[model samples]
Target chain A: MAMAAFRREGRRLLLSPVSYNSSFAARSAILSYSELGPMGARSISTQAVRNRMKSVKNIQKITKAMKMVAASKLRSVQVRTENSRGFWQPFTALLGDNPSVDVKKNVIVTITSDKGLCGGINSTSVRVSKALYKLTSGPEKETKYVVLGEKGKVQLARDSKNSIEMNITELQKNPLNYTQVSVLADDILKNVEYDALRIIYNKYQSVVSFLPTVSTILSPETVEKESEAGGKLGILDSYEIEGGDTKAEVLQNLAEFQFSCVLFNASLENACSEMGARMSAMDSSSRNAGEMLDRLTLTYNRTRQASITTELIEIISGASALTGFSQSARATDNIQYRRYACMIKLQS
Target chain B: MASTAAAVPFWRAAGMTYISYSNICASLVRGCLKEPHRSEAVAREKVHFTVSKWADGKPEKPSVRSDSPEE
Candidate 1:
């Protein structure tokens, strides 16, 4: 009972110094239990505590640095993404977004980052791409994947290895530009034959939020068909061509230009989303590390104090026992002297 | 928009593929950007990498190549 009461008092004292709410007591208890479970039977030493603190501190430093780097990169990428919007938005407005347009052959371009440690952006892209594949696959409809970035390639290769038509990596080793992206688009266009090109990428909504978006570009033949059948391209008939180029040739050029423009814009947006996700991810990691460090410091202090208290108690109890033994010895001596005096008195 | 009525773009008249035409257009756009962004955009277009062609389920030897905006 006394030991339990002493333990409660010690906890109260420890909790008071930390100034955490009552809930922290339970949380700390859980944390300490989990931490101690793996090192069963061994007492918590201050040396071990210090080592763990050092490691956590190092990790916290790394996370903080990563967050800062991501933040700076996000600023630049955000600007580029905004600027690149002009490059693609006009094409979308001109061509019109036809998500439901039925096409025979489809090429799905999954855009993701080469590096990870960003949140779930890559996985989200892959998931959306997979969902899109399932939606678009049919008996007559053929679907192929052109995965961009190493991360998406590895993930998509796991399930749809045979379906991957092309995989491009190291595209983001340098900053993205229209020229670079156009070359990539041209390369893809030459390799894959698709009536409709579906580019899947993470669209940056904000620093903390992003949406997986699929933008489609229809081939010139498909556009002509839509124009004739659905009158979707009726607006095209009204436009005057200055170059003596036929409507078909104009549509062809527009389709190719629009493809590259949209690709460049999508890559920029994905890069922005990646940096933003990474920043937030690193920020949360640093915050969690701080909380962990606080808990560890508390446990370290508690362990150190307990060891000190045990040593002090051992010393005090040992000294008191010695003094008590001497007192008993002195009492025995008094009784012996008294007995001796009584005997002498009787003899007299 | 003013250039829309201009005679078919020079690249198109010169019998260039859409790739080279678009690249020239992109460089022209980059060249027209303001100071900081122009340099940044120009720098970004300077890409160097190794490209390998795969044949018979085997990758050919990779070769070092740089892709400049200027063809």
Candidate 2:
């Protein structure tokens, strides 16, 4: 209980410092990056100058720390993303070429993370989804959305007239299985009258930028030339479908398998993008907080010095007055002692 | 809204083995006559599934151990 009270008091003191305004004033004092950079020609006040230096130093420390953390996370996520890359190339390539079934029964599977604050990763994907929706908005074209994240569901739901067929929010908790994806794939293939399917997701470019990409998940006929072209590029050995099954039946099964593969890949990319966005947002916030602390410390120091100077002046004046009063009393006491000695001599 | 094909049994359609109904397996085999990819992938997967189950009810690796002392 005592510890809690102590923490509360500490928080209050930190919250209501005398120099809080100075910190806010410091940030507002500078507007542009050029003004903040080495090339700007504004001569600042000594106090403001000191505060700015301190604030920038504080900001540098925070951004540096955040950059390190992001770098580490990017390394791990990059590995996972890279490992899953080859797994889907054949699937995606095969699905691109085969045009066996009608696409009117197709569904677009969109993968997005549940959380936000990862830059514009989610927004970019949402925008792409909206674009795709607009393209497929004809009266007879049956298009339904299957969203993986609640954030994407909410965003796409606003613009899309078609009902969301499924929303899978437990992506992080549950490792997506072929069984689950097959159920969705089957429903999409057999139940809906989709002509083709597409997926919109953030393809992680770097720690800072994620490109929102719209990939075709169905209508395999579009991929024939691309696959053939990719085959000519000298890496076609793994692209071979190894089975004795008849071409039509083999292609159909391969289509479902490929769609599931792409769906899983999109989910992973969404996770990486979400984490990266969160890391960057948190970094900027910590930097802003650090700058505030610097300006407040400067103000607190100035106020303390002024109060000390006032006390010093009062002390000096009181000392001088005491000296004058004591000197006069000493002179009077000397005169009285002399007078008393003279009177005693006269009386004797 | 999507259609729920409740009249058609689960195992008859293109579904993973574990969740499929018995009737669907027969349908799948018949369906394989026309759709070879579905048949082949299912056949390959089912072989793996059967081999993983041992005579003593213990689960075993699907790979054949050529270096076993008994062999």
Candidate 3:
């Protein structure tokens, strides 16, 4: 009967999720104990349990610290992202969006962060860039990528290695600004020959959510051609030229300036999204660690109590056998003791 | 609608390219911002990176470059 009771107890301990962390020796000991009865399983090592708990606690601390850091960074980047919308929105309104117009040569600027542990922000940008490539590329249409930051480059280089024209890294070491972005834009314009520039980035929608967005800016030549072909030049024709500059020159200036503005705003938005994603990812990791710690602690306490009870029973049974006490009385005593232990467990 | 005036921007009259013209405009806007935000924005603009051009599915050597708003 005692052997049956110990076997049942052993089975319950082994079934717990906490047992997954148990070392091979400890698990083998439990298995042998269940088969050989209480005498064998008596030494379920709480030492291994304690070690696992310590490691888990250290991990939780690191994740908690990362969460706090990400939160603080998110605040500053969010402010910059909000303020930068005003810098780019006016230019976007003036130049207008021509989504349906097809351009033969395209430069896709994929924007992402350098460091990771931020969720899917980089992957989303790469995914959207690949989708854009599929939509734009054909025998006649050519699409090239100007990948910014390290994370996107790593992912894009896996499949679309041929399409990548330029790779820029370490852009996130400092905070982003319009002047820096304009220089990058100028370099891109000087290097790549494209009729349209498509920027792919994660747009920060909220603390927990972000959307992959693509904003396209037509080249001045493409704009002029589209306007002439469409024959709806109300907005562009309205602005009068000054300083003896031709309409084409003004359009060229506007296109270049607009690229810098949009690029600046997109980089800021991606930074904000990266921070927010990291904050949430770290938060969930810490929470999961906490939950695991709670379960392991409970199992540890239970194992300690079970081993103590087994020792006590061994002593009592030995004494009763020597002192000529009835087996039935000792069995009853053991049942009562088990009930008391269960009460203590419930209280704890 | 009010009559739109035809006036030349100073940068354009000086024959500056749009990149330099816009950089000056951005710095001016940054200067106009209040207190801590102005300083913060200015600091954020300081960037350094290594750019590498890729050809035939391989990356060439990288060149280190730093860019500041003042330049």
Best by DockQ: 3
lDDT of 1 by residue, A1-348 (tens): 654554454435433433432334454456565675444233334556777999999999999999999999999989989999998888877779888888889989999899999999999999999998988899999998888887987798777877877777788877777677887777777778899999999999999999999999999888888887755666876678885776777887888888888998999999999999999999999999999998897777666444433433443344435455553344344434544554455445
Tell me the tens digit of each residue's lDDT in model 3 across A1-348: 765565455445433424433443465456654554464345556666888999999999999999999999999999989999997788767777665558899999999999999988999999999988888888888899999999998999998899889999887777776677777887787779889999999999998999999988988888878777654444677677777666777788888888888998999999999999999999999999999999998887777556655544564465455544564365546546664766587557
* Runs with alpha carbons beyond 4 Å of true place in candidate 1: A1-44, A325-348, B1-16, B25-41, B48-65
- Candidate 3 chain A lowest-lDDT run of ten: A13-22
Mind listing the fnat for each candidate? 0.20, 0.00, 0.65
The DockQ score of candidate 3 comes to: 0.35
Local accuracy of candidate 2 as per-residue lDDT tens digits, A157-270: 665634565555544543333333444444345434444667778877776788787666543332333345554322432456554433333344445556656665666676
* Structure candidate 1, residue pairs in collision: none
lDDT of 3 at A38: 62
* Candidate 2 chain A minimal-lDDT segment of 10 residues: A37-46
Off by over 4 Å in 2: A1-74, A95-106, A159-162, A174-193, A219-247, A306-348, B1-71
Candidate of highest lDDT: 3
Candidate 3 TM-score, C-alpha based? 0.80
Per-candidate iRMS values, in order, are 6.2, 16.8, 6.9
* TM-score of the B chain in each candidate versus the native B chain: 0.57, 0.19, 0.50
RMSD per model, one decimal: 13.8, 20.7, 8.0
TM-score for the first chain of model 1? 0.81
